[model samples]
Target: MLRNMLTRDELIQWMRTELPRLLQEDPAFRAQVIGILSEALVSKGELTRLLDELRAMREESQRRFEAADRRFEAIVEELRAMRADFERRFEEVDRRFEAADRRFEAIVEEMRAMRADFERRFEEVDRRFEAVDRRFEAADRRFEAIVEELRTLRSDFEQWVRFSQQEFAALRVRVAEMGIGLGSLGLRMGQGLEEVIRQVIESFSGAGPLKAARLVLIDEAGELYQPGARVEIDALVTDGRRFLVEVKNYAKTDEVWAFHRKARFAEAKLGETFEKVLIAPAATASAVALAKQLGIICYTFRAAESRETSE
Candidate 1:
């Protein structure tokens, strides 16, 4: 008959109870079972040893895997730190570049402003220069006008001087002709006076000749006379004053008796109280001395002759 194989738990329980029972009931079977059991125990010990070895190998593999995992984590942390450092450095470099760009842009703007300011100043300077040039042109025009006016004035002055010189020359010629005519008329008048003076002298010789004679005459109504005549009159009058007259026309005398006679006649005409007698055509030194003693005045026609003479 086939016996039932024990279940794992039931076989473990049956081997504990039945193996002891079979040993008690059958010695030979008990010995064979014991030997098999001993063999099974040996096999189980070997399996336990193998299992422990496998568990030790698994623990060693886990330890090695864990260590490798920790090393990998450290390497990952290092890589992350390096990546963070690189990113921060890149950000700093970018910020610096941005700041530099802003500075460069500001500098460019400043340069543009400077250029504009310079252009404005240059334009102002150009305008000022243009104004100066205009002023210079105006001044030049004024100076030219002044020069033209001066030239005109000089020409007028020269013309005036020339005209004045011509007028002066004509005036001088007219004056010379007037002088020559006056001198010729004077010579003719002197030539016509000779006989009239002789008649006057003959009238004075009559007895009891007047103490004074008055004759009022205009310039051109006199009778004509000769160039040389001498007349003595007892009395003559001019402006109501009685004077003894000795008329002379181109007659000169140095005789002292002639002047003494004139003074004596003046004394008789004035009743011995006459101051002087006039002797025309002034006498020489001896005549002047006698005239001085007898109280006679003497004059000459030389002044009238000088007036009639031509230059």
Candidate 2:
């Protein structure tokens, strides 16, 4: 019964140790155990039944083991397929990694080439800039030379200006001396001309227009002459009415207007209308016009030319 309860390895161990001890403990035990087993043995029919049950159990267990073995083989085949799929995917991943590494290497190489090209171009630009700097230095030297020439020219111009100023001052002094002499001569000539005109007026006596002709200096008052103004008349004559003549060396329009004002003042003072005349060496066109507008006769006398009258 204990052997039946034990596993195959446990049953072999118990028999190896315990069977010899039991035989030594009882000499007749073995025969008695055989006689009891013989007495307790099943009949032939019972033994045949037991053998059939055992065969049936053995067949069942074999069938079960075969089913388990088939299941294990199927599981092993599935695992093998999974492992092959994993290896194929891993190989694809390795190829992808290699391709990416190649692409990265290409990019790095391209960048290195670009950097080297840029460095070379920068060196060329630096050389160009150096050449430009050399040209600027040459231009600066030329500019300095031009500046020096301008400074020399300015100095000469300043000296010329100073000499011209000195020469102008000397000429101005001579001109002033000549002006004084001319003034004295003009005064003498004017006095002489006045005397001559007085003689002419005197000779004109017993004439038609100049029957009572005489030269007189008038004192009068107007814009050009205040009260008691000393005014020189070139001739005081009677044409049908009184006449006042003005004598000038050179007559301009302003002198004509001034003489008209004096005539006005004289007319006011004497309480009589008088004809006005201007005598000169030469009169400007504007002076002749003004004299005509003012009803003043203008006469020009030159030794080399004919005596002209403003009609």
Q: In the order shown, what is each candidate's alpha-carbon RMSD? A: 31.1, 20.4
lDDT of model 1 at position 9? 84
Off by over 4 Å in 1: 1-46, 115-311
Residue-by-residue lDDT tens digits, candidate 1, 56-81: 99999999999999999999999999
Candidate 2 residue lDDT tens string, 162-181: 99999997776455434434
Residue 44 local lDDT, model 2: 83
Note the Cα lDDT for every prediction shown.
0.58, 0.71
| Superposition error at 134 for model 2 (Å) | 99
Which prediction has the highest TM-score against the true structure? 2
> Candidate 2, which ten residues in sequence have the lowest lDDT sum?
299-308
Models 1 onward score TM values of 0.25, 0.31
- Model 1, CA-based lDDT: 0.58
Candidate topping lDDT: 2
